[model samples]
Target: PGVTRDRRYGMVDWPGWRFRIVDTGGLDPSAHGILGAMRTQTLRAVEEADVLVLVVDAAEGLTGVDRDVVALLRRSGKPVVLAVNKVDSAQRESALAEVFALGFEDVFAVSAGHGRGMGELLDRVVELLGPTARATSDADADADSVDADSEQADPTGEKSEVVSSGAAADANEDPVTDLALDGEAGDDDDAADADDHADGDDADNDNGHVAGNATDVDTAAAEAAEIKRFRRPEGPIRIAFVGKPNVGKSSLVNRLLGEDRVLVHDMPGTTRDPIDTPFSVGGKDFVLVDTAGLRRRRSVDTLTEAVAGKMARDQLARCDVAVLVIDAAGGATVEDAKIAGMIEESGRGAILILNKKDKVPKSQINSKIDETKEVLSFLSWAPILLTSAVTGAGVAELPIAAARVFEQASRRISTGEVNRFLEGILADKPPPAGPNGRHVRLYFATQAQICPPTFVFSANHPTAVPVSYRRFLSNQIRQAYGFQGTPIRIVLREHRKKRKSAPPERN
Candidate 1:
C-alpha cells in the first residue's frame, strides 16, 4: 500500500537471480506537497533494498549527487555496490577512479546498455543478496508478485536512523531527482521499450570487471571527482520533454517508459518539478527528463509557478536533447515556438512531438503537421513525430530518433577534414568583396567544441561576413557532416598574423 503513482517497483530476471528495483519520483521537500510523499516512498526503497546499486553515469562521470548518495548509502547501513553505468568502451574506463572517492567498498564500471560488466555487478549483488533474497520473497508471497522483494519486512520501523542530520543536509544541498524505471515486465521488450533494448547477442558478460577499491577522501580526490562529474555527458544522452501546459508531456513519457511512473492530470501544473529517469535502447543508455510545462512569462505571476518554470528551463540546459510536445488538437501556438526557441537557444538537440493524434482526424493529420512545421520553422532541424499517447502510436521511435540527433550534436570532425570541407564551400561561391574594396582572405577553420558542434573560421574581414553568408556556411557544414537533426554553429573571427618579437638576450 506504500507504493503510489510517484514510485513504481519492478523485478528483473538475470540468468540465475532476480531483484526488485524501485523507481521513485523526487521533488523538492521544502515545497513539500508532492515531494514529501516521494521522499517517504524513497525511504521505503532504502529500507527494503538489501544492497543499493548507486548508479552513476560513467559518461557524465561521478557527480555531486553521487557523493550525496554515498552519504545516504553509508547512513542506511545497507550494503551498496556502485554501478558506474554507461562505460560503453575502455576509453571511458579511466574516469572510474573518481567514483571510488565516495568511500564505496565495491564499484563496477558497466554499460547498462550493452549489458557489459552486468554479470559481475549482479554477481556481487547476488553475494549480498544471500539467504535474504529467498526469505524476502517467501514472506511477501500474498503481496503483489512484482514488489515481493522490494516490499520486505519493515522490522525496525526505522533502522537506527543511519542517515545522519549532517549527511542529510549535505546530500540535500543538491538532491538528485528520483524518477523511476524503464519498461513494463512481461511485455515484450522489443515492442514495449521503443523496440530498443540491446539484443541478447550484443550483450557480453565480460568487460574485464573487478571490484574497485575506495580512495582516501583527500582534497585532491574530491577535486578530481568534481572535474570529471561536470564534463559533458558522452554516451547516455539526456533528453528533456518540454512544452506548454497540458500538452501530454508526462503522458508521452509514461507511454515510452511503458508505465505510469509520473502523475498525469488535466490540471495545468500537474508536474511541478523535473524528474530524471534512466533507460536503455539499442545498447545506448539515456536519461529521460520530464519537466513541468511552461506558461507565458507574463502569465507566470505566482512565485511557485515561476520557480517550477525556471527549473524546467534549467533541466533543458542540463540535457543534450529537448523534445518539444505540441497538441495536434490545439494546433501550434506562439508559446510552443517560444518553448522550442528556448531549446534552440540552449543549443540542445530538439525533437518535435505532435501528440494527441487520436483526437485528430487522419485526413487532417498531414495538414496539421505541415502547419505546425511552418509555424515552428526555427526548429526545422528537429525531426517531428506524430503520435497518440493514449494508444501509444509512433512513441516507440522517439528514443531512436533522439539518439541519432544526440550523435550529430556530439559529432566531431578532424581539423583537416573541416578545412577541406571549407575549401569546397569557398570554391563553390567566392566570398563577396568587402565594401572597403579589400579582398576577403579566409585563412582556415577549426572545430571549437561539440554538443551542438561549433566551428570557428579565421579570416581578415570578420565584419564583412553577412548574415546570409553565415547562414550559407551553417547550411553547408551541416550538409557536409550530415547533421540532420542537430544545429551547427559557425563563427567568423579576424585572423591578424602576429609580428614576431625579437628574442630577449639570455644571461
Candidate 2:
C-alpha cells in the first residue's frame, strides 16, 4: 500500500492491527519550525503504537537520517522491529550487519522484489504482534454483529430512520427530538409522536450542522459511484462543441480524450444521445459533452435526425461554454448560424470551432471567417479556433481556452472588491437622480452566493435605481471582472437601517 501522510503521521492496517506510521519528510532534527512539528507528530504516533516498525532499504544501506529515526524510536521506550528490505542475493546479506549496529537486535531480512524469506519474515511479524492479536473467536463475534445489523437495517442502511429522526429538530420545530434525547417520552406516546413526525408535512431547517455532517457521508457515496470529482477546471472556463449533421463531434471527442472512447462514423446523425466525458486541463476538470448534431425541422427529412436534434438542444441547457463546430472545407452555411443563435440564447459561454482547417486555403479562411461573423454576429464576443481533430493540430489549446471561460463563468467578486469597483464606476458615471426628488445612492454590495454569482447592493431609494442603470452596472461588473459567460442577478436592497427606521406610514 502507498504511504498516506496527514500532518507528520500516517497510518496503515496490518492483519488484526492498526499501525500508526509516521513520515519525517526529510526534516533535519537540528532544524526549527517544520522539524519540530515532524518530531511532535512522530512522537505522538510512536506513543500510540504498540509496535513500531522501522523500515530500511537493504540495497541503499543505513544513512544518518535513519540513525535520527532510530534514536527517536529508542527514546520512546517502545518495542521496535527492524525490517531490512531488498536482501534478495547472498552478497547483500553483509549490508544487513550495518543496520544491526543501530542496536535493534530483532532484525528480519526479506526481499520485497524477489519474495525471498517472506515466510520467515511473517513469523517474526506474528511474534511482534503478541498480546494485541485478536482471538479467532472474536472475529466470529464481529461477523455475527455485522450480519445482524445488515438484516435489521435497510439494504442502504447508511442513515436509517433512527439516525434521521434523531435530528428532526434541525429540519423542523418538533419537540419529539428533544423529548427522545431527554428520554422523557412514554413508550406508547413516543410511537404516536414519531408517526406524526414521519408524515413529512413540515419544512424546518433546525439541523445547524447538516451541511458539515453530511459531507463525509455524501463524499464516500459519490466515490462509490465511480465518478471522480475534482476542482472545476482551472479558470472555471467551459467550451462546448455543437454543429449540424455529420459534423465531427465524436471524432473531436475521441481526440480530446486521447483514445477511441467515442464511436465515430461517416454517417450523418450517428450519435443518438449526448455523452459527457471529463478531463483535466491546468489542474482543472473540463467536462466535454459530445452532443448529437442538430438541424432545423424544415431541413430535417428523417425521423432519426429529429431525435438527434432534440438531444443536442437538451445538452445546451446545462453547458457553461459552447463551441459551434463548422465544416470549414464544406463552406459556410445559414444552418450553422441558426445553431450558433441557439447557443447564445442558452446564455452559455461560446466558442467557434472551424474543423477541417487543413484542407481550407489561407485566403478562403478569412472570407469564411467573415462569412461566419456576418451570419452569427450575435456571438461577436466568442473566439473562433481553426482545428483538425485527426491531425491533433490546435486540439490541445481548446480545452485550456474552455477551462478559462468556465472559470470566468463561475467568477464572483469579493464584497470589498465589488464595492470598490462600484465606487470607481459611480465616480465615472453616477446613477441619475430620481423624478421623485430622491437621489439614488448606491452603497455597499456583496456576492450573496454562486452558481451564477448573485450580487446584493444596498442603496437609498432602491426603487429609484432604474432598470437601465441596473443593466449598466451589471455590464460594468462583467467588463471589469470578466464574468463573460455568466448571467448576473443584480439585487438592489434599501439600506437595512433606513428601511427599518422609517415609522409605519399611513397607506
Candidate 3:
C-alpha cells in the first residue's frame, strides 16, 4: 500500500473521451519523514488536478488519514469522486455505507485489483470532468473518423501505390556511387523505369506535357509524404534519470519539467517508483522518468528499498537514454560507476549529468569533471554536463543533447555505404594475421540493425578476428558516422562459399 512515493501519470482513452489519470502517494497528515514529504506532494497534486478520485480501503473503512485528505481536497474546491476499493463481491458491497459517511456525493464501491465496479466509477469521474473535456475529445474523434473515411474511400489506392514505389526507389537508390566496391551494384531496370516514370511522361504533345507535369506533381507529393512518415519517431523518447540516492535526479527532472512533478527532499530514497512524466523541449517530445536512487545490494536494508532499486534498474533497461546523475559536490562514487556500467551494459544512449554544480566551487569544476572521468573512464564516450537543478544551469541543453544521441542511435547505414566505408578502412589498415599465421580477409560489411546501430562483417575466419581490430573498426565507424553518446555493436560472421556437387558420383 505504500509503494507509490510520487505522482504516477497515465492516460485514459475511452470511446469518445480521453483524460489523464494521476495516481498519488498515500496521504497521512500527521506522519513524519518520507511519508510526510509524500503528503506534501499529494497536496500539490490535489491543488493542480481538475478532478480527484479519493480511493479509500473498504476493508479498513474511512481512517483518520482518509478524512484528513478529504478535508484537504474539499478546501481545494475541485470535484472529488470517492471510490471504495476492495469491494470484490456483492456481499462486500455493504461496506459502502461506512465510506458514505465521508460525505462524497459520488461514491462508488469499486474493486481496483479484481476489476469490479470500475466502469461506473470512470463514468462518474468523466462526468465530473464536465463538458470542455468531452468537447475536445469529440473534436479529436471526429478528425480521426474523417481520416479513416478518407482512407476507406480511396478506390484508386494511389497513395498506397506511390508510397510503395517510393520506398522501393529509396531502397534501390545508391547514395554513394563514386566508390566501386565488390557486392555493390546499380539499380535494376524496373527501378530505373519507375524513376523515369516519376520524373516525367514519355510523350511530345502539349497534352502529354500537361499530363507529365501532373504526374510529376503527384510523385513529388507522394515522395514528400513518404519521407515525412519515415522520419516521424514512433513515440516520445523515454529518458530515465538514474543514480545513487540524493544525487538530484528528481531535482533535475523538476528543473527540466519546470515543475515539482515528483516529491523532492533532502532524504535519500525520497523517490520510490519510476515516475513517467511527458515533457517536450525544442520541438521534440520525451518522457522523463524519475527513478528511485539505487544503492548496493549489501546496503539495501529494507524490502521497500530493494524493490525500488530493482525498479530503478528495470527502468534503466527500457529507456531510450539513461542519464546517470552524479552528485558533483561528492564527486563520482563507486555506486555511480556501477550505475554507469549498468547503462553501458544495457546498450542504451547515455548522458552523464554532474548535478549540484553550484555546490562545487567554480575553481574546482574542471578538476571535478576530470576526477569523474577517471572513475568512469569506461563510459568516457558519454557526454558529461555540469548542471545545477537549484539554479537551472545547463539544464536547457539536456534535451538537445538527448535528441542528438537518439538520432545517432537510430541512424542506419545502407549496405553500399557501409561497404564503401569498409573499403577505405581496409586500404588504410588491413586485418592483422591470426594466431595460426593465416591471413583473415573481410569480404564485406553491412548494417544489421539500429538503435545502438549493429553492423555485421562477413569474413573468411570470423573467430580469428582480434578484439583490438574490432575496437579499431568500431572507433573508425564512430569517427566516420559521428555515432557519439551511443554504443555501436560489431558482429563478425564466416562468409560461407557454395560447394560444387559431384553430379557423376550422385548418378
- Candidate achieving the largest TM-score: 3
RMSD of each: 20.6, 23.9, 14.7
> Highest lDDT: which candidate?
3
Off by over 4 Å in 2: 1-240, 280-284, 329-334, 370-374, 432-444, 449-471, 484-498, 501-507
TM-score for each candidate, following the candidate numbering: 0.58, 0.46, 0.76
Better of 1 and 2 by lDDT: 1
lDDT tens readout by residue for model 1, 82-168? 777678788789888887777678888877577788889767876877764443345345232333332211222211111111111
Query: Over 4 Å off in model 3, which ranges?
Result: 13-17, 30-33, 88-95, 130-232, 498-507
TM-score-based ranking: 3, 1, 2
Q: Compared with the true structure, what per-residue lDDT tens digits does model 3 show for residues 279-378?
A: 7777897878888899999999899899889988998666889999999999999989998999988888999999999998899999999999999998
- lDDT (Cα, tens digit) per residue for candidate 2, span 1-507: 111111122222345542223332222345445334334434444555556666676767776766766776677676777767777789889998797787776787877666676566545555665655444455344321222211111111111110100010111111001101101134344233223222232222122111111222222222222321122322223345689867787778779878654446576665555555555667775666777778778878766567667867877766678878889787658888788778766756777888888888888989878877777776766777788888988888788777666666556554335545765776678777887676666544555434344566656568888999998877887787776545566777654331226788898
Question: Which ranking of candidates, highest lDDT first?
Answer: 3, 1, 2
Q: Candidate 3 at residue 403, lDDT?
A: 93
Better of 1 and 2 by TM-score: 1
The worst-scoring run of ten residues by lDDT in candidate 2 lies at: 160-169
Off by over 4 Å in 1: 1-231, 501-507
